[model samples]
Target: MIDEATARERVVSTADRLFYAHGVQAVGMDTVRAESGVSLKRIYALFPSKDDLVLAVLRHRTNQWNTGIAGAVADAVTPRDKVLAIFDFLAAWFREDSFRGCAFINVFGELGGGSNRVAEAVRAQKASFQCRVAELVRAAGGPGYLAPQLVLLAEGAQTTAAISQDPDTAAHARAAAETLIRCALGDSENAPTV
Candidate 1:
């Protein structure tokens, strides 16, 4: 007998990859079963429903995605630099061949209106990410408004980069963010005199 825990992990892992690569609405349970090699009975035994599997994948991907972005900018000399490093990190992610934009944004576009759970899960991820950005902004000695504005820039950069298939969108956003941060911090010695 396949262990239930093992089966659950396999299903969620498979679901995450497929659902992220293909929108959740597009991938069916059978495809998951075929790709995972987990029997349908075992899949149902673990998740009982497609919705459940999707939730598991969203939660898992949210954690993984947030962790990855955080990890990418963990090594900065200053808080402002750390915030700037986020753009650099995004450029790297955008360049990946497998890059498919933000999973939360993709799923929300597909099912946010019909699925409350998906909307909430995606909302939670955005809120959590904003909170992290707020912390970084605080460390950087930015004003209160800077946090939300910075998150906005980050989100806008993500979507623009994906839509344009331009990895340098992050760099453009970074320039704007630099101006905002300096404005917030009242530090413009580095700002161009032009």
Candidate 2:
């Protein structure tokens, strides 16, 4: 017999994969059950409802997003490099075979109008990400005002890359971010770009 935690993990991970590739509304519980190999009874017992499962998926994805960004930043040697590393992460993520844009944005576009919980979760995740960017901006000696602009660039890049199927969108966004960072932080013109 599978333990509750193991069953829950299977369901969430499977749901995340399906929902991201298809969409939140397109895939149903039965599909989740069949794909995950977790019985419907176990899925409902663990998630209680589709909304519950979706929320769990969002939580799982959020953990992944945070870990990726943190690792990217951690590998950088300087504050400027740390800030730029976010786009490096995005560029790499955009090139993944399974790339389907930000799950939070995808779900919000599909269900944000009808589901308050889903909307709130997406908003909270985005806010957390923006806050992280803001902190990085401060550390990089950029003016506080530059964070939102940088966040918007990153957000826009995700959407553009997903829709255009162009991994270079992140590089374009990275170039814009470098310019913004230089302008806000007063970096010399001779500073290397890239």
TM-score result, candidate 1: 0.92
* Distance from true location, Cα of 160 in model 1, Å: 1.2
Best by lDDT: 2
Which parts of model 2 are misplaced by more than 4 Å? 189-194
* Per-residue lDDT over 41-158 for candidate 2, one digit per residue giving the tens place of the 0 to 100 score: 9999999989888999999999999999999999988888899999999999999999999999999999899989999999999999999999998887788899999999999999
Q: Which residue pairs in candidate 1 have backbone atoms (N, alpha carbon, C) closer than 3 angstroms, thus clashing?
A: none
**How does model 1 fare in lDDT?**
0.84
RMSD of model 1 against the true structure = 2.2
Q: State the displacement of the C-alpha of residue 32, model 2, in Å, after optimal TM-score superposition.
A: 0.4
Best by TM-score, which number?
2
CA error at residue 36 for candidate 1, angstroms: 0.6
